[model samples]
Target: MFLTNVLNESDCQPIKKSYDQWYTFMDKNVEFWLPDSELHTKNHCARVLLLALLIGHQKGLSHEEKDTLGMAAAFHDSRRLNDGVDKGHGIRAAEYYKDFCREHELPYDVQTYYITSYHDQDDSFGLSEITNSPVVRERGVLLYKIFKDADALDRFRLGPNALNVNMLRTEEAHRLVDFAKDLLQKSNETNS
Candidate 1:
């Protein structure tokens, strides 16, 4: 009931028809969480979805994959609350996703779980080790990578003045990083 009023069964009927029956159930409860001020917001999630869609399209993902990625982007930070405790938001979000899957009688794959659970971990989460695992390498690590990168891009957009160089890890992600740095530099120069 999280997305209860925001998005309904009709809005997700197409997704349900094309993918799995559980999509409708997932969509209904996906947006239930309230984000904290310091963390990302619905606006941030939207921006990340847009960016992820663009990147995914450029990467030539199928329509189904794009839809899945878009859904993930929307629900990535769905567990954040305004109290400033982001400790287990990803895990909480995954739990929500699992519940939705269970309610609709869908297959809950491990990759899907990790994709949602670690969307925000960044390099600090030691994802590289897991990603390097033969199993993950064989799957689609790129999907998760792009999702994280797109989310980071929007984070920089939300506070261009506060982003540091250390936040960037890939050349593709650096494009947004440089853009934010340039904006901040221009703002400082204008003030001076």
Candidate 2:
């Protein structure tokens, strides 16, 4: 899948450079992942990054927050072995995240690692009960929510039943769900 150019110029600018680097990395490392999985490709990562940026921007997060989310988005699934609910891929990806950061001398904090590692485990979609839980509230909650929502928004790629807008965590994410769906539809049509 190719990266979608659906975002506005302002929204795309910050992520463009990172995505450019990610695209090259993905092309080089394509053989490390499941090539045909709708849910775990570099294109999905790009979409997630876009979604994370939109949500973070809507919530008035800092540039650092957005950039961290971008990093989590890009490497969230870098270590996936298969598409069938591989339970520990997040941990593996987190490990790869560390290596990637160190190898490229990129800056990252522990929170970014937590966000990437836990992104797949919680699909709370921002339910107050879950969001209020100690685990989520402890650290990186905002970025975690943004990452989770960004990843969930892409569930449209998994088909209609896969996405539940109400399950989305933030108001902005709920509002953008349909648009995400539209992007998936358009992407499919293009690929078709």
Candidate 1, 63-176: lDDT as tens digits = 756666666765677777543436677777777777867897865555556667777565557377447556543434777776777776655544655455456444555555
lDDT of each: 0.56, 0.72
RMSD over all Cα atoms, model 1: 8.8
TM-score of each: 0.63, 0.78
Off by over 4 Å in 1: 1-28, 35-39, 83-85, 106-109, 124-129, 132-139, 169-171, 176-192
Candidate 1 lDDT for residue 60: 66
Clashes of 1: 2
After TM-score superposition, the amount by which residue 126's alpha carbon in candidate 2 deviates from its true location, in angstroms, is 12
lDDT score, residue 190, model 1? 42
